[model samples]
Target: MTWKLGLYALAATVAAAPALAQDAKTLAIVVKGLDNPFFEQINLGCQKWLADNPGSEYECLYTGPASSADEAGEVQIVDDLISAGVAAIAISPSNAPAMANRIRQMAPSLPIMTIDADFLEADRDLRKTYLGTDNYLMGVKMAEEAAKLKPEGGSVCLQLGNVAADNINARAQGFRDTASGEKGIERLTGQKGWTEVEGCPVFTNDQADLANQQMSDVFTANPDLDAFILIGGWAQFAPQAYAQVTDQVMDKLKSKDLIIIAGDTLPPQTQAFRDGRSHAQVGQRPFEMGLRAPDVMLQLLKGETVEDPLYTGLDVCNQDDPGFCKDN
Candidate 1:
């Protein structure tokens, strides 16, 4: 109508346009420890989802402890991304509860998705959904397989990457619960929670090496250890070291005698399982975590409901049966 009113309207529209553009901007993925294949799977998933959605893009930033035990490292990474002003953050948290308040403080409205390890506290406010394996079930799967390998389970040792991680903790719980449920199995005390966070041991770039050494030390210390269940990446190295040490101790003992059942089938782990150096493993579809996590985040951003608390299916890799144990 009036020239003054028209000018005001034009300025208002221009101001609103930038806000809208900012709303349509790409996402940010902040993960813990880029060094691990597990996080690599999440990266792959996020990138593939962004590629499929032509207009949307993503920026991925990773930080974590020198070892798998460092949960704090993951929280610091989330903080860094918030400072950088990200749209959304997809993380496989080392410590879900510990990182919750920090992320909430940083980006309260920013859509957060947890892959692999999860945080229930974050679900109430800061985060939208979690995508990963049913870690407790994964633990149960490991124990169930351990039973098959050693019907009379004597001593089971757990070698997990990060004890602070809820997922790893849940899996460990599941393993212990399942093992206890069984009539014959007796859980051992070789489970050492290692991480890259503060206070945890430092071997981030060299987790495989640490895993190898740890396994060597565990078996060497306890000759009575009947079964070994090492979850996550350390599972890969456990058998190699077990093979080496066990071979040195008793040449007649086959690798199967120890009843090794590990979790999260990476390339190395899958290869090891396939080669029969290890017994069986619980495989988390990590690639799918990377692929599906972004979609879940997008859904949350659009105010859509995600059916599963944990997305991305999981399965057991039983080397005894070649099909279940194959690599992705």
Candidate 2:
């Protein structure tokens, strides 16, 4: 499978960083967390790419923090990779702004490329290119799904992951914009049925226990909650988290009084969709993101230019239209 990046003229000269050895090139991929199945697939994709392209003169070094919210740890990992003289870096930032600043501090010296997530608008120049799903469109699809489930005006709550992540924020805003425009859907805000537990909506930190507790609290507080638009499939990641909500609201789910729509159809999330626990899953190609990053980085290292803000693609899966759901 050949991956083609749209070519462009180089704007600035990118100096190759000092490599570990002259014969082999070392590339680093820093994702949100290895614990997440999505990121695990990404890591596997990178491994597969390396295996397929054995003669490409590149070796991949993959690592990430234990938790998604460990911004400092992620920064340290990047610093360590830089110190080790990695030729290029592909990162899915936990915090976009911080990662962008860090990249800026090390720019030109070390070419940075983003995958899965992206940097902010003002700091986008720090990175060579971004390859991931259209997050805003993902949110728009979530909103459209919610409207489909409840055609006659119902309330919906959004479950989000890290608040500072550019992807999360974009998806949330997209959902809000599209859902607000729908006359039948009312996006709940404030502390009534749709409220934040601590300071924000279920910031799961990619932990199943935290996702379970946060979801249970929301379910307990909002018995009248018509639909849930989960921007991140944190609860579906682990059985314990899945049970936390399923055990509490199994009857409601069976009755079709409440609908749950989420993002990312990993094995567990796909099974949930199959079993009718979740109505739909928004699928993002994280594997492709990983597969393409090294290729893109290699191009940059060789003083070749590619298009900025490259989009992978997205799809919505359900019992009715199980598009990539069956593949999972």
Candidate 3:
């Protein structure tokens, strides 16, 4: 079940956080935020597993900060969850470094793993395992899709979720490397004919409306921009705002004059692509992450080793493909 943490619980000490139904060992899926639909899919997967194994000894507890950008708040939630004596935790780590530091402080009291996002390589020993997308490769596929749409390589804008998120950073680096045809270039500005427009690569902090506004503002200011890459689906998460913003550039989208290769093919995002608002999408399987994480954590609790990074894989849909996310 989801966390019923009220404001008082959040504002008060860790003791204030409810430790409900201790009889059933808690297999918690603590995500970056409870708001993002991508994470919701993860929650649903956890719930689905619970429903399937009704007689199981463990319960899936999904909790997180209300706001995606609240890095400190996410850490606090993790602290509370650990104090509540949950059997295991699968953290998405909104801020990877902060979470890793916190994990270090606790020193692996209970089985801990990362889901969707992971800690840096130097600090990965803090978690038993990581279960999620190959973020860098996800970014590589994103760039590949954009390149397919706009082969000549022109001015581009990257929409990032969190500045400190290792996953997002990896995706950004992957995009830069692939798009520029230069491995490990810091920023994209006219390398191998691909350039990151001035004031581009706006960090959305995982705020949907603001991401849409930033996208609108960036595209409005730079109408000549050839490609827009959303490394996360922040803007598209708010479908109405995304629609309103992209409507202004419908002509360009229609003629393939501009390409928007976004990450995450949630229902709304997929629909947006079908509606011609976005050109392509590279999606991460959060549901699969959620579905498998509990088992992974349970195995860890049993002192069984799991894969270091268990990749759930990705799904790609492009403008040229008419059979994207459709049943035969």
Question: Which candidate has the highest lDDT of all?
Answer: 3
The sequence of per-residue lDDT tens digits that candidate 1 reaches over residues 247-269 is 54353235565656767666666
Alpha-carbon shift of residue 55 in model 2 (angstroms): 3.5
Put the candidates in TM-score order, highest first: 3, 2, 1
lDDT of 3 by residue, 92-196 (tens): 888888898988897566788989898989988788888999999999999899888778889998999888898999999999999888888889878767898
Model 2 stretches astray by more than 4 angstroms: 1-23, 182-200
- TM-score winner, 1 or 2: 2
Better of 1 and 3 by TM-score: 3
CA lDDT scores, all candidates in order: 0.60, 0.75, 0.83
The number of residue pairs in model 1 that clash at the backbone is 14
What is the RMSD, in Å, between candidate 3 and the native fold over all Cα?
6.4
What are the RMSD figures for all models against the true structure?
12.2, 7.4, 6.4
User: Which residue pairs in candidate 2 have backbone atoms (N, alpha carbon, C) closer than 3 angstroms, thus clashing?
Assistant: none
